[model samples]
Target chain A: MIEVKDLSFAYRTGEADAVPALRDLNLKIEPGQLVAIIGHNGSGKSTLAKLLCAVLYPTEGEIRIDGVPVREENQWEVRRRVAVVFQDPDDQLVMNRVEDDVAFGPENLGLPREEIAERVRSSLEALGLVEIGGRLIEDLSPGQKQRVAIAGALAMRPRFLVLDEPTSLLPVPVARRLISTVGDLNRREGMGVLHVTHSMSEAALFERVVVMDEGCLVLDGTPAEVFRHVERLREIGLDVPLAASLAHRLRSRGTPLEGDILDGADLRNALAAVRESTAS
Target chain B: MLELQRNVIFGQFVDTGSPIHKMDARIKLIATFVFIVASFLIDSFLGFALVLPLLALIQLISRVPAGYVLRGSRFFLGFLVFILFFQVLFYPGEVPESSYLWRWGFLSISTTGLYTAGILGLRVIFLYYVTTMLMLTTSLVDLTNGLELIFGPLQRIRVPVNELVLVFVIAIKFVPIFIGEVERLARAQTARGVPFDEGGAFKRARRLGRLLVPIFISGFARADLLTTAMNTRSYRGGRYRTKLRQLHSTATDWLMLLLVVAWMLAAWQLPDRLLS
Candidate 1:
């Protein structure tokens, strides 16, 4: 499990004024958990992701990967265990060839030829990039390049994978398919995933959703648990699904809606059960 | 409107699966070094006559289309010819009166000058062709690995061969990306009615100045990203870095090396004797 102990981070600009990006944020993500951290821009979701990856150390508090506290000396271990796929694929993919790019992480680890080859092959296969392994990265679409970037990270065989707005630049269908692939990876490989996104629908797909507002995590629970805070999420400049919004409004007007409502289907089921109970 | 990626053919590898393409990159690098040396050494017309066929043969065996060479060299070739004209017109060497074809004081065109210009032209042309073919056939990764393994002995002198190779490989790999960015920036300017194509050199450069600043900013930003990405991927220079693929030298590679040596020797010694 990856654990955060009251993690807080601030960027120092000028001497006296250090901008706080994360304020006493605590999160626990176990392996195979599909968790989404949702917030508007500058809400510290990405800050938390970077802290977990050890790309940026916390100004205060700690992030422990598999029980070891993340620090400068052991940052390499954190990197190996927690792989991050940043926003732009073009920025991360350094190699021209797809297979070579995928092999980059393992290559850096200095694995033997056979092991590296196996990892590259398997990673390519995992991302459905087997056929285009030899293709140039320039020739690939933005979505395909994103897939290649993920494949490179996967080759590291990290226990936790963090995606910080990976679908922001991708088309809708491509982003959906990529997310579905990521979901399958989380289940099949049983790696912990923290998907940091602003899309409410995308966040809803996760088993757990964490809401961030102004550098603090405001809500953390199942999607239904989190989405039920429609007015609260709206106040924080984030959208909620329409059904959840309706459910929240109805519950405010003295309706006995007890469960977390995520979608139209969940709202319909709850309303039907409520009507049947009233008739009985 | 500019398709910069399509326009870029340099430092690109064509996977033709040809005999020459399959040859070991170590041998290719060593042979290319020899070719560079021989290009400067072989001076006679007979020597060039002997070398041209060898390059053409290798090109044919590599299966890389000749259009790549011609298209890539068009501007360079034109510039070379123009430089050769000036070189012949103002030949600075001891131009004996007997070798002068037409005399007008310092502006005479001499047979010796023409001969020297011809030799210079051939040397540069061959150098460009051979190196271009090497790049077209050998992938950058193979080239990097080849250089590292070939220069593996230099680490005893604390040469940092692997880091140097990384720099070289990354620079070469960034060529297409850099070009694509220029295209994107240029197209963006064009879309905003900046008029990139409608200007003299001075005005064009002024417009390009606008593009250059952003390219540099983006370039620095990309370099930062690449560094962080490599770091997150656990890249710590060349030490403790292992390659997934190993290059093996086949009999064909040995044969190709042998042929290059034979050609070099022949071009060095047999030129005047055989042709005379």
Candidate 2:
């Protein structure tokens, strides 16, 4: 399990007025749990992601990966437990070829050559990227490149995978596919996923959703429970998923849509049930 | 109009499933250094003639097309010709009266000058080919590993050999990236009415200066992102880093090393006045 306690982070901008990016935030992610963190720009979601991977230390409180506190001496251990995939795949891929890039993580960990090679093969196969393993990263499409980035993280054999807005640079269909792949990995491998995104639709697919506003966790629950707060989400300048927004409009118009609709299928089933009741 | 991608092939690696390509990169690196030094030692045309068969044998073993390898050195070939012209025309070295072919106001041509120019051209070509072959066969990762192992001893003297190798490898890798970036920037500037190709040398250079600012800024931004990415992947320099592909020398590698050493010895002992 990954745990954060009263985490607060402040960046020193060399000015007297230093504003903290995160304030008194606490979170825990159990193994195999897939959670999404959604917020508007500058809401400290990315900062939390960075902190989870020990990229940036918290000014107050501490983060722990499986009871090991994140500190300087245990950085490699912490990183080995939690691997991060950043937004831009272009910047994240250090090697030219896909296989070499995936091998980078294990290589850094000083694994044996045979073990590193095995991890590279397994990671690429896990992502269904074995065909492009020998291809140059520059030649791959953005979606493929993003998959390569994920493969690199996977090769590290981390228990927790933190993706910081991984789909921000991808096209809609590509993003959907990539998220589905990530979801499959979480389900199959029992790896905990902490996905940071701005898309409510994307967050709705997660097992739990955490809403951040002004460096504080404003809402946390299942997607069905969280998307029910349409007004609060809009007030924070965050959009609810399309289905939830539609359901909210119908309820406000006195159509008795009695439940939170977090996805298209949920809205469809709910609308059909309402029609049957009205017809009866 | 900027076909920069097609034109810039120097230092680019081509994967040809050949024996030479499969050899350990450290072996190739050392052999290349040895061959280059031997090339400089051989002053006679007959020495170069003797080395031609060996070069051909390597090319055959590498399976890389001769034309493809030669094409990468096109730009250097032009520069070599320019230098050879100057050397032959000026004839800087002392010339015997009998050997002088022509002389006019600090410009002279002689038999020895022609021989010197030929030898110098051969040396340049040999150096270029050896280095180019090394790159064509070895990937950047192998190059980095080989260099670090080769220079591993220097770390005891407080030299940041790992970081230096990382910097060198990154710099080499960035060549194609920056070339593409420059192409994109030039295209954008062209769309914005900047005439990059219509000016004289100074004017073109001034126009290029405008392009450098954005490139440098973007380069810095990329470096920042790369550092974060690398750190996240647990890259803490080369202090305790292990390689996925270790360099193991096979029997063929040892044989090749032996052959290179023997060739260097022969070149050192060969007669330099074979054609004189």
Candidate 3:
């Protein structure tokens, strides 16, 4: 299990005034679970992600993995456990070639040559990037580069994967494919996932959703339960998915839809069921 | 043309199959020194005639284009022209034989002056081609490795050969990055309506100052991140380091090296008066 208990952070050594990037935040996540953290920009989503991966030490409180606290002494181990896919793919790719880039993390651990090769092949295969393994990272498209970044993290074989807006800048279809790939990894490989996103559509696909407001976790629950609090979500400058919005509007029009209509196809089916009932 | 051809020296590795490329870099460095000495020794017109053909033959064996060498030597050409003009116009005393190539007002040419200009120009050309060939064919890694090997004896005096090699590797890697950054900064300055070309000397200097601010800022930011990444990978100082590509000597390399040594000896043994 991964746990963050009352963690806060500040970056204040520069000319910029000291300001808390993350307030007193706390959360716990078990293995093999997909959790979505939704928040606007500068609402502490990225800072929390960095802290979880041990990229930045928490200024106060403690973070632990399986009861072992994350401190300076155990940072390398923590990093090996939790792999972070950064927002920018350019910053994450350490090598020029695709295969070399994917093998970077494993090589850093000083793995044997054969083992590194095996990990690189398996990671590329997992991300469906086997064909582009020999190509350079700069030659790949934005979506392909994002997949390559994910493959690099996968090569490390971390138990928990933290992605900070992995598909926020991608086209809608590419984002869908990336999230579906994440879903596959979560289910098939038994890896814990913390996907930070601003898209309501993407967040609705997660098993659990946590919303942040002004550097604090304001709400945390299942997607359906969270979306039910429509007014609260709006007050925090967030939105519900289109399907949920339409379902709520229909309910206000004296035609209630049953079950949580989060996806577009589900909403269509629910509307069809309602029409059948009215005809009868 | 000079301003545009500045990137020619930055021609990193073209993989030409020239004699310079075939020889071990250690041997090449020695050959370059010998060739430079020969150019200086042979100051007569006949000597230049022999040296130019030899330079051309070297270029042919390397398979690198001749235009590249010419383009890479632009600054050297300018400097050579300046030196030639100084020697021809201001040689202290009176001329023994005034050979008027072109009498343009106060400027008059003499046989000694013409000979001086020819020798100096030919020597400069020889130097440029030798250096260009060395850089074009040898990879930066191989060059550093060769340097370390050539200076291996200095290790007895506590010289840091490995540290020097590492520094060269890092410098070569950062050169391209720094160039790209300067290009970006220049573009940003241009976008701000700062005409870098149309300014007086001081104005141009001030414009450069404005451009450096952001470049340094971004460069420091990148350096901090790179240092963190390097530290995370445990990149300590080079001690007990193993290389992925080891330098191996071949029969062809040895043969070419022998030929160069024999030629250098023959040239040096030739009568000094004939050589001049």
Q: Cα deviation in Å at residue A77, candidate 2?
A: 3.0
**Rank by lDDT (best first):** 2, 1, 3
State the lDDT of candidate 1 residue by residue for B98-154, as single tens digits: 887887867888888888899999999888888878888887778888999999999
Local lDDT at A231 for model 3: 81
Reference-based lDDT, residue A252, model 2: 82
**CA deviation > 4 Å runs, candidate 1:** A13-17, A249-260, A264-280, B44-46, B73-121, B201-206, B274-276
lDDT of 1 by residue, A52-90 (tens): 888888788998999878888888889989898999998
Off by over 4 Å in 2: A17-19, B44-53, B65-71, B74-122, B153-161, B261-273
Q: Rank the candidates by DockQ, best first.
A: 1, 2, 3
Candidate number that wins on TM-score, 1 or 3 = 1
Provide the overall lDDT of each model, using Cα atoms, as 2-decimal numbers.
Answer: 0.87, 0.87, 0.74
Which candidate comes out best when scored by lDDT? 2
Q: TM-scores, in order shown?
A: 0.90, 0.87, 0.71
lDDT digits (tens) for residues A128-161 of candidate 3 = 9999887756568889999998888887788889
Give residue B95's error in model 3 in angstroms. Answer: 13
DockQ of 2: 0.68
Among residues 3 or more apart in sequence or in different chains, the pairs in candidate 1 whose N, CA or C atoms overlap within 3 Å are none
lDDT of 3 by residue, B1-276 (tens): 013324445434556555567567777766777787776776566655655566677788889777776776675676678778877875523555446555555676766677777777877777777766776777654676678888878888988886777566555545546666766777766777767777565776577787667878877776665544443332344443333234777787777667765665555455465645
